[model samples]
Target: MFKYFNPNKVFFITSKAPKYVLILFIIVFTIGLIESLILSPEDYKQSHSVRIMYVHVPAAWITLGIFSTITLFSVFGYIFKNPNFFLISKSLAPSGFIFNIIALVTGSIWGKPTWGTWWAWDARITSMLILALFYGIYLLAWRIYQTQDQAFKVTTIITILGIINIPIIKYSVDWWNTLHQPASINILSKSSIHESMLFPLIIMTAAFALFSLLIFLMKYNTELIKIKNKGLDRL
Candidate 1:
């Protein structure tokens, strides 16, 4: 299906990305850290600890976002029989898993002070845990299947199946009464948060987006290198 296997296009995109994106990411991340940690006002309820939400919330958002992207690629690979699509999906799994873990860890840390417990069997937390488990299974598919094609097929199925959980996680708080807060940016109203808090939150979200893009680009480049070397080995 991928008739346009343009190595020159991929190389140009990958090589040109690092220079501009890296500088932008570093600058944004630094500004975001300062805004969130130093300038933001303390929460009325949780006080300073509420600042952690900047990191925790963004991590959670990115984790889900990455998984959704992977699922899309998996679908594309399955439908079009595209090896490049599968390769990109596989490369993305590691970063998705890492972000999922970060979200879980940071959520637990934030929960302890706010909820009086590190974790609960609440809908939100449980759904996030399920996401992590699916990531593990996706990785395992790669290791267990002997052939790359076989692994890609299996993992693609796994990824597509796991996507069902994304909506559940998103609506978990609303679906069932839970400790987790309801959606902040929604149709009902503007976010309940104040300007001081909102500014940092936006900064941090942008930083996470930039960081995810940077990492994805790097991983994609590595996979291209591996593919090139494999061709050499075959020759």
Candidate 2:
């Protein structure tokens, strides 16, 4: 089964996906910007500054989502001896790290106006920062290790340990006294965010997801090329 995942075979299919993804990304992102910036209503208190939530929330969501996916791929790759999984995980890290930074920066920008501070030791904020650190360490492991086996094992361990932080980050606001507000969107119950704002948030999230997919394809293709250059037929 894993033989079917050969880099050559995979590249033939995935390499063609980026161009289409890029087109869709541009269309969705333009719509997201219009909906978020021009259509979404201002918060009763925060006014225009509230618009930052469109970016901050979606970036945070993407960061967490990507890390979870990285963890799954790493664990499964290690268990199944699938080098392709590691390649995919490695390709995903750049986008995850990028979104983590975006979330943190935009959070800080949103904070100055909302919390009246540029930075704080709030639980959610602190946990998010820790998640970003884990992303850094995971990416660093790939570069620092000389062998694929070594990198795979180390990154798997890092992701397994890092996943424990995900729950903490999700529940930090509820479990502690934090400047960060509790979640506005709930899966099992009615969300606090109005439909107008929620619609744009969802669109922005979709746009961001497409962008990450575009990045992953580009990185994955490069890795495949490297494998080909090394005269390897399969990953």
Candidate 3:
């Protein structure tokens, strides 16, 4: 599946994506916004501003998810010798970088009220910053190297090395004392949240997933056209 990710395949699918996904994204996202801002109960402890969780958590989740995907794409790019996989990884980075910024900024905003400070040099926060740095370097690696092959290898190596940070980001609260709170919606165990709050969160996450795909499809299509124009259709 990864190896066969060619221009024809990407363009064929992405060209039709809006026809299928955009309306649904808008509707679901709007509903989620209403639920989060108007209907969902505020935290008894944190009050109204807890609504930031709707944005912060989803952004953080997608950032981690996209990077994991980029790492897998990098692995398959090498194993299958497919440049299309590399392009897909490249296409994903810009959006992922933006989401990473959103997560950090929102986190700091949330932190200011909760922790009484805008920034803290704790375990999870530090590791997340490292993850952002890794992402930054991965994006720059593509431009710093002149040739496609060199850029691919350098970025791939960076992506692979960066995988170590993902687990640390996830488990940092457990490994050490941190200002950041532990996970509330655990998959391995029962979630600590109520259904009312969880429903909006789930809806928001789905909407984000849709929007992220929509963005990636557009970016992927752009890259496909670029490859075609460069006369590298065989890649």
Best by TM-score: 2
Q: What is the lDDT of residue 207 in candidate 3?
A: 87
> What local lDDT does model 1 show for residue 90?
75
Top candidate on lDDT is 2
Pairs in clash, predicted candidate 3: none
Candidate 2 stretches with Cα past 4 Å from truth are: 1-4
Report lDDT per candidate. Answer: 0.85, 0.95, 0.88
lDDT of 1 at 36: 93
Q: Is candidate 1 or candidate 2 better by TM-score?
A: 2
- How far out, in Å, is residue 145 in model 3? 1.6
Model 2: weakest 10-residue lDDT segment is 1-10
Model 1 residue 172 CA deviation (Å) reads 0.9
Clash count, candidate 2: 0
lDDT of 2 by residue, 102-201 (tens): 9999999988878889999989999999999999999999999989889999999999999999999999999989989999999999999989899999
Error of 3 at 157 (Å): 0.6
Number of backbone collisions per candidate:
0, 0, 0
RMSD (CA, Å), candidate 1 to true, equals 2.3
